[model samples]
Target: MKTDSQLQQDVMAELKWEPSVHAAQIGVEVKDGVVTLAGEVSSYTEKLNAERAAQRVQGVKALAVDMTIKLSQLGKRTDADIAGSARNILSWTSSLPTDAVKVLVEGGWLTLSGDVEWQFQRQDAADSVRYLLGVIGVSNQIAIKPSLSATVVKSDIEAALKRRAMADAKTIAVEVKGADVTLTGTVHSWAERDLATRSAWGSAGVRNVVDKMNLV
Candidate 1:
C-alpha cells in the first residue's frame, strides 16, 4: 500500500494536470489516508473540480476540502452583465425555473436562493452558477417544493420504497407517509442499512427519510 505521504503526492500531481484548475494556488496534505485540500480558486466549479480530483485518486480513504473562492473578479461586472450572464445560463438549461430563482453576487460570491419543484432543479441552479466566470462560490439554499400534490408525494415515496425493498430482497421494512419515509426491520450488516437510506434518497418527493432499521 502506498503511504499517506505518497498518496498525497499523487493527488497533487493529479490536481496539477487538471486543465480547469490552477494547481499552484491549491495545497494538498495527507495524513493516515485522509487527504486535505486548501487554498483558493477563482470559481465554484474549480473548487468542486479540485475536490473531485482528490477523491478520484485510488488510495484516498477520505477527503477534507478547505478551499476558498475569490469573488473579486466578478465585482467589476455591471449588473446588466451579471443578469445577462445568468439569463444565458438559464436559457441553456431547461431543468430550472429561470424567473423563480434569484441570484445575488457580492464581491464575486454568488448566492442562489429559491424554491424549485424538484431536487434536480436545485442541482441545475447550482450548476448554472458554477459555470459563470468570476464566481467564487455558490450557496445553494433552494427549497424543494413538490409540483405534485401531497397525496401523490406520499404514494410515490411508498412505491419507490417498496420497489427498492423488493429489489434488495432484504428484511428492511419501509413505511412512507407524505414526505417522510421510515425504515424499520433488520438487516444483516451496516452496509445494508446505508443502502436502504440511499434508496430512500433516490425517491422523488421524499422530503425527509427516517431510518429506523436495525442491524442484526
Candidate 2:
C-alpha cells in the first residue's frame, strides 16, 4: 500500500509528465487515497487533462477537482464566437451527424442538446468542442436513441467484461432498466472499475450508466 505522501508525489509526477497540463500551476493534496487538485489552468481542456492525469495514478480512491479555468487574453472569446466555433467543429467531426446536436452558449459554458444513435456520438460531440478557446465547461444533454432491449444490453456488458478479462461476469451484477444500466460489483482497481463502466456504456442504446462498484 502507498502512503499518502507517496501517492501525492506520484500524482504530481504524473501531472508533470502529462504534456497538456501545466504541473507547476497545480497543487496536489492527498489524504488516505483521495486526491484533490487545486490550481488555475489555461483552458478547460487543460483542466480536464489535469483531472485525468491525477486519476491515472495508482492508489487514487477518489478525485476532487478544485481547479479553475483562467484563460489568457488571447484565449477568451465572446459567447457568440464560442457558439459558432462549437457548431463548426461538431459539423466537421465525421463521427457526428449533421445538425444532430444543438449548441447553446451562456457566458463561456457550452451546452449541447439533441439525439444520437450511439453513446460514442454523444461523447464525440462534446470532445469535438472541448478545445474551443472560450469553453469553460460542457453539459452534454444529447441523448442516445434507444434501440436494443434491456436483456441485450446486460448480455453485451457481460460479454465485454469477459473479453477484457477485467472480472468474472457473475461477480459484476448488471441490471438494465429501460435504457439505464446499474452496475453493482467489486472491482480490484480503479482502472477495472472504469473499464466496467465503459463496458456498460458501450452497449447499444444505453442512455445512462450508474456505477455502484466497490473497490477492493
Candidate 3:
C-alpha cells in the first residue's frame, strides 16, 4: 500500500499530466488514501478535469474537492448571456432533444431541469454547457423518464453485464426497487466498480443507482 505522502505526490503528478488543468494552483492533501483538492481554476470544466485526474491515480480511494472557479476577465459574462449560450449549445447537441431541457443561470452557475428518456440525454445536456465561457458550475437536475418494468430492468442489466464479461458478474447482486437499482458486490479496482454502475444505469427506466460496491 502506498503511504499518504506517496499518494499525494501521485495525485499531484496526475493533475499536472492532465492538459486541461492548471496543477500549480491546486493543493493536494491525502489522509488514509483519501485525497482532498483545494484550489482555484479559471473555469468549472478545469475543476472537473482536475478532480477526474486525481481520481485516476491508483492509490486514491476517495476524493474531496474544495476548489472554486475564479473566472478570468475574458471568461466573465452576464448570466443572461450564459443562459442563452447554454440553450443554443444544448439545442445544437444531437444527443439531446432541443426542448427537453430548461436552463436556469444564477451567478454563472447553470442549473438544468427537464425530463429525458435516457440518462445519457440528461448527461448530454449538462456536457453541452460545461465548457461554455463564464460557466462557474453546472447542476444537472434533469430527470429520467421511466419506461421498462422492474423485472425487465433487472434481467436486461444482468444480461448486459454478462455480455461485457465483468469479472464479478456472478458475484454482483442487482436489486431493482421501482426505478432505482442497488448494486452490491466487491470489485478489484475502480474500473470494475464503474463498469457495474454503468451497467445498472444503462437499464431502461433506471432513475437512481446506489453503489454499495467494495474494493478488494
Candidate 4:
C-alpha cells in the first residue's frame, strides 16, 4: 500500500503532466487515503482536470477538492451572464434537471447545488461548466437522490441483467425491495457480474443494489 504522502506526490506529478492543468497554481495534500486539492486555476476545466488526474492514481480512495477559479479573462460579463451560462449547459444536457439545480457565480467561480437522479448527472453538470470559456472553476455540491420504488427497482434490475446475460436461461434471479435490488445468479467472469450491477444502478428510482451473483 502506498502512503498518503506518496500518493499525494504521485498525483501532483500526474497533474503537472496533464496539459489541461496549470500545475504551478495547484496544491495537493493527502491523509488517510483521502486526497485534498487546493489551489487556483484560470478555468473550470483546469480544476476538473486536476481532480481527475488525482482520481486515476492507484491508491486514491477518496477526494476532497477546494479549488478556486478566477475568470478575470472574460471581462465585462455580469454575474447573471455567468450563472445563466452554467444553467444553460445543465438544461441542454439530457441527463440533468435544470429546475432542481441551482447555479451560483461569484467572481468567475461557479457553485452547483441540487439533487440529481443519477451519479452521471452530477458529474455531467460539473463537466458542462468546464467547457464554458469564462468559467474559472466549479464547486460541485450536487447530491444523488435515488428514488424509492420497488417496481422501478425491479424493472431496472431485469433490464440490466437482460443486457448482460448470455441467454434467457442463465438462471439469473432478481428481487427488489424498496429502493434495493438484489441479483442472484452465476456468471462466467467478474466483469459480467460487475456490469450487471452497474446497469441496475443506471436505472431511475434505484437507491441500492445487492449482487449475489457467483463467478465461475
- In the range 88-148, model 2's lDDT, one tens digit per residue, is 8889999988899999999899999999988989988988998888899999999998999
Candidate 1 pairs with clashing backbones: 71-108
Tens-place lDDT digits, model 3, residues 1-216: 899999998999999899999999999999998899998888888998998899788867888999988988998999999999998898899998769899999999899999998887877788889999998888999999899999999999999899999898888999998999999988877888888999888987899899998776
Q: Rank candidates, TM-score, best first.
A: 3, 2, 1, 4
Residue ranges of candidate 4 with Cα displaced over 4 Å: 83-130, 136-148, 154-201, 206-216
Q: Please state the error at residue 68 of candidate 4 in Å.
A: 2.0
Q: What is the C-alpha lDDT profile of model 4 across 36-118, one tens digit per residue?
A: 99988876667778887887777776689899777664543666888888788788888776586788888667899988788
What are the lDDT figures for the candidates, one per model? 0.71, 0.90, 0.90, 0.75
Which lDDT tens digits does candidate 1 get at residues 172-215? 66676666668787655444555667666556666566877654
Order by lDDT, highest first = 2, 3, 4, 1
Whichever of 1 and 4 has more lDDT, that candidate is 4
Q: Name the TM-score of candidate 4.
A: 0.58
TM-scores of the candidates in the order shown: 0.66, 0.95, 0.96, 0.58
lDDT of 4: 0.75
Clashes of each: 1, 0, 0, 0
The deviation in Å at residue 211 for candidate 3 is: 1.5
**Residue 98 of candidate 1: its Cα lDDT?**
61
> Model 2: which residue pairs collide?
none
